[model samples]
Target: MIESTTVLVVGGGATGTGIARDLSLRGVDVTLVDRDGLSSGTSGRSHGLLHSGARYAESDRVGAEECIEENTVLRSIAGECIRDTGGLFVQLEEDDPEYFEEKRAACEAIGIETALLDADEARERVPDLTPDVERAMWVPDGAIYPSRLGAANAADAEEHGGTIYPHAPLEAVSVVDGRITEATLGGTVERTIEPEHVVNAAGAWAGQVAALAGVEVTMAPSRGVMVSVAYDELDPVLNRCRDPADGDIVVPHADEAVLGTTSVPVSDPDDYEKAAWEVETSIEECAKLLPPVADAPTVREWWGVRPLYAPDEAEGDRRGISRGYFVLDHADDGVENVTSIVGGKLTTYRQMAETTADHVCESLGVDADCETATRKLPGADDADRLDELVDRYDGQGPTDKDVIAQ
Candidate 1:
């Protein structure tokens, strides 16, 4: 038997679930499917540091502004899914002082709250901080539990009458005459789906999904490693106040600290070289900021692929690619009813979904304003309930494996 929905959303990560919740709240019928489970892709494999916009303040002004705005909104609505641990961009003795000043000035210019802390003052906040830290700038950065966040969004969408299918992979898509007529989903929910609109939020695999519909989405995915070590003393997310490089950030958790990451682009997101150097280098660099993590006893390590969109020709260092999200209307490429949302950070998933939902709603002529920003997700305030939803949706991932029991 064939099924149908007003909207078919691919991928069950934060962004896909966010879109489902947004559209469902607006009286839209939505069906979301994931090849694996919620957050099983890039969303679930992150170091899970909630950005405070300070990291990108110097480089991308507009991206930083969007991050700060969404960071504030998530703190309000995400509840237990987020931790208000604050963030510190430390300038070590070996680091550039001018770069530190530049970031501080950029944050101030963009209205991102920040405070300059001397080495003595910074050590007072986090005693485990390296004494090599010459100074530090404090921002509103925090920690995020992606499993809980993804589950809450999925639960909210389900409450609003949206259908969610975990372990349901989109096997094929039928695009006829500039429109997507049908989509064939495999795995547990093997069936044919007729949809009025299709959203490809498949993260790193977005290019593959788009090709199923005969659309081209240039994705420049890079691999990064997150090493979680057994450390309980760190109180805030630590960012190296210099150029964006491997092991620049450390995200603290209940009994662990996640060290991340190295950027090396790959031709295929699914299959890439998992070099030992990536993991070794991340731990070595992160240990500079928090020296104790060097011997903290590694708990577990996982690699996450960044779902970066490169519409233009390939260039040097994939790190130069923008982390900003883009909502692509495939109609420009000949498919009218298919859209792809690509290249965004986990911190801005809600905004990414809001933008994609708005475009899809407009294309479908559904006159409805977005309510996701204001409406708190289901299970937002309850950790147990959120974990239960995570299990229900099979949303557990290595990013928060320690936080949420499988």
Candidate 2:
């Protein structure tokens, strides 16, 4: 099947979905295509943490502000996707207290609320936390539900005249006159698509997508492993209150706690092996904050890569690189008629989309302003009403209602 669209958005992860939703709401004819179902990539595997901008306080002030702003917007626009589980930055017996103080001060300066909670009070709120917890501070922003956000975006896009092509991987790219004209998808059911403008939002495999279009994108697909402890292990997001390094933060999902993430730089995004060592290391690291979790049963494990990027010509390892999205306008990069929104975090996906859509719209001569932000997405208001969709399917089980993140 061959199709044409005014704007073709590639990748169905957070960034891609956000762009599709924004462009579609602007009344543009948009088509979002992904190799697999939405969040089958990194966005699906991430610890559902709605960052309060504290993690980047010491290093990236700009990112911190952006995190706070987006966190607030998502709470409303994607309300069902988030819970105000109030995050707690725990200070261990040996960890530096000064760092905690600095984090608190920095977050407050940027209008991010932070309150010191005594160890007793902290344990009172979240009884599951280890009693040995020395101290903790409450950050007013933090929550989870990546799958909900992705679904909400897809629904919003559909409501505004957008199409999503899932399980449809791009196989080839055809260019004419230094511009992309057609794209092919592989599988038992093959397909093709032609678009006036294309946005490369592929996460880890972004490089491969760019190559298909005769352009080079140097993206380091660093794999990180996460473990899901099926327990209310922590009441709030438990941060180590230091530089982000290896399995430090434990994010709480619906009925489980997700302790992540060991960064292992990989050569391919398709590689998904949760190494025993990675799992062991994450448990060991999480124990540093709450020893009780050392005995908690791990219900599930997952691995996903962060799509870190650098210049196509230079290489400096993905770990040491800064954390932010890189929006490269193809015209400025000499790749004409294409733009790549690479890197960045789930928290800043909306901003990333707004930026990418601006560039894509410019190329297509579309004057639509971005509305992904400042607008409420579907299911953001109530999860129960959205649950009615399951009934729409003739009494399908809850799990069958939506193939979403658990």
lDDT of 1 at 151: 91
Candidate 1: which stretches are off by over 4 Å? none
- The pairs that clash in candidate 1 are none
Candidate 1 local distance difference test against the native: 0.93
Best by TM-score: 1
Q: What is the lDDT of residue 178 in candidate 1?
A: 82
Clash pairs detected, candidate 2: 247-260, 324-344
The lDDT per prediction is 0.93, 0.77
How many angstroms is residue 94 displaced in model 1 relative to the true structure, after the best TM-score fit? Answer: 0.8
- Output the TM-score of candidate 1: 0.99
Alpha carbon lDDT at 269, candidate 1: 88
